[model samples]
Target: MGLLWGITLLWAFSFSLIGVYLAGQVDAYLAVASRMALALLVFLPFWRPLPWRQALVLMATGAIEIGIMYLFLYKSYQYLTVAELLLFTIFTPLYVSLFADLFARRWPKHLWAPALLAVAGAAVIRWTELSEDYWKGFALIQAANACFAFGQVWYRHQSKSTSLTHRARFAWFFLGALLVTALASALLADWQKLPVTPVQQGVLLWLGVVASGLGYLGWSYGSTLVSAQQLAVMNNMLIPAGIVVNVVIWQGQVDWLRLGLGSVCMAGALWLCRRQSS
Candidate 1:
């Protein structure tokens, strides 16, 4: 559980860096395709190959989490600003919890407070990112968030009985599924626009190997240690709350009021998480 939270924070922050770096470079389809290919290569050796069941799950998971969700998000950047993208992302958890309830049939003991606090924090984060055109990005971002959040929980469920050794049972499924999704993306998108710069290459490397691979491993293993409700509270890391603060700090614009607001948001998240854990 501790490791899951720790890695969650790191991956959340790293995703922000990746998102900012990818700004205006390419569409989400190509971006996800390129990144997913690399991720499959990295994980290919883990398991010999995948069974039909695992392969299907991986493909389905990739379609929702990467293909449909991310591709739409990429298209969103074309229409909306970053601020709007972040705001709509806050709503994703609500969708995830709904999926969890329908599938898992319950939340943690008392999750409404932290859940509500997390929603408020999302509102504050959205407020910070608001723009006239950013609202246009809301639809895609919201879809991406819901897909990702639900996919995470579903993926966890799929791997529930598997061992967590280096020989991960899910690796082949994840890789094969990603490969198919990437291939479909290639058929649908302009593949020539890929292999752009060293920055994109490096970002894809990090996203595939570290963020998607290791971060997911952490999330999967961590979920085993924590309750679904706890996992939901921990999912707050998706918002990149800390990275926003880091950006503000880097700019040398010290606004105590905004900082205090962010701090309150963090505190609420923390308090709610603690309550869930207890």
Candidate 2:
């Protein structure tokens, strides 16, 4: 849990950095590719060939989990503010719980009520001012959430069956993610919008080396140390941490009433899920 909390703190500033420094300013694919490449480098020294089957599974998980997830996540900043982005991510825990159950082939009948509550929470945010751009961003976030949730569930299960230490096999994960992002950058990145400013370059370096490389390794290892219920709760912890970082550090304004109400609804969902799981 300490490791997870530390990674959460490390990641708290990630959304704001991307929103302020990379998103819309730098090409999303290029930024994602750069981050993945640098992150991959961190684990490259530990690389050893896993069984082909294990390698493929880990690779596939990385592609969906971080690679494609980042694509959606980075693109989201074009439409959503840091506050709105953080608020919408409140649904992630619910997705995590749902996906875990699905992979286990068990349906928890009680999950539906909390799921609806979570959706209501999202609806409560800016419901009066819905627009195409807002909905697009929301959809992109949900997609990223699903990818991340699925990957967490997958890795937690997959890691248990593997014999290699986390450091020994984790590079395969980043290698998989790198392939996806690198291909996307080659095909779709905007060459004209590369990172130019020192701040942009520095942010990318920090995000790649520390926040992503180390943070994800810590998170994946920590996920193996805790209960699914605990993991679900920890996933949501990033919300308040991120919102506070965005608000206090960046002076990002949030619609307090809406944020409060939405947060209550989302919190209720988490509580209900926790109660059900327990």
Candidate 3:
């Protein structure tokens, strides 16, 4: 549990920082493609070759899980600030909770108020992004967040199956993710022109190996270890950490009033999550 928490914290920090990197780097999809390629290269040897059957599943998961998510993320980063990007994330847990209720036949109890609070808080945080450009970015990031929620739940379901070791499955998934993201990027992005930088390469490498691969694997493992409700509760902590990290590391502005509102949102969300868990 502690390791999982650490991994998640690292994941959160890494993702927040990647915005600055992506802002300066090559095309977003291309960056994703490159990172996936690098991660695949690193993970394949450790996990061994895969059978064609499992590879297909990996490919599908990768396309939705990585390909589309990265595409829009990059697109969103183009217009949205890191804080704005994260503000949209407040909707993901709410979406997942609602979806789980519809499909699984039981909604998270006592989540209504907290979810609403979170939404309001997020709106306040993102109030500055009411411009047309920010609105578009907001929509894109929301889409990515929705996809990420789906991916986590779907991958959790897969974790329960006996078809393959988690490590191996993760590796195959990375390989498929690379291929899918690469093709998607090629189709969607202009390869003729791209930002070139040494730091960009370094950031991409870190994102691939440390952030996506290990961070995801750890988060998945934690989800499997802990109840979804508990994980959901803890997930709110990421907001404060994100805000702080942004203010300190990125030299971003701090709106104390918004931060206070975010705290209330997190408190409500946590309370609801705990209640749901019990």
lDDT of 2: 0.81
Per-model root-mean-square deviation over C-alphas = 3.4, 3.1, 3.1
lDDT rank, highest first? 2, 3, 1
User: Tens digits of per-residue lDDT for model 1 on 57-174?
Assistant: 6668756765577666777877776556665666655665667676767653464556556667656544663566655577778777887777777777766655545335446546
Query: How are the candidates ranked when ordered by TM-score, highest leading?
Result: 2, 3, 1
Q: Taking the tens digit of each residue's C-alpha lDDT, what string does model 2 give over 1-278? A: 78988998889899789878877798888888898899999999999977799899989988999999988887787888755676577678678778877877887566556666766776565355344468888899999998998899899988777788888667989899999999889988889999999999999999999988998889988988875656666676675566668888999876778768867876786677677767
User: What's the TM-score of each model vs. the native?
Assistant: 0.81, 0.84, 0.82
Q: What is candidate 2's TM-score against the reference?
A: 0.84
Model 3: pairs clashing at backbone N, Cα or C within 3 Å? none
Question: lDDT (CA) for every model shown?
Answer: 0.64, 0.81, 0.68
- Identify the leading candidate in terms of TM-score: 2
Question: Which of 1 and 2 is the better model by TM-score?
Answer: 2
Worst lDDT run of 10 residues, candidate 3, spans 227-236
Count of steric clashes across candidates, in order: 1, 0, 0
Point out the higher-scoring one by TM-score: 1 or 3.
Answer: 3
Model 3: number of clashes?
Answer: 0
Residue pairs whose backbone atoms clash in candidate 2: none
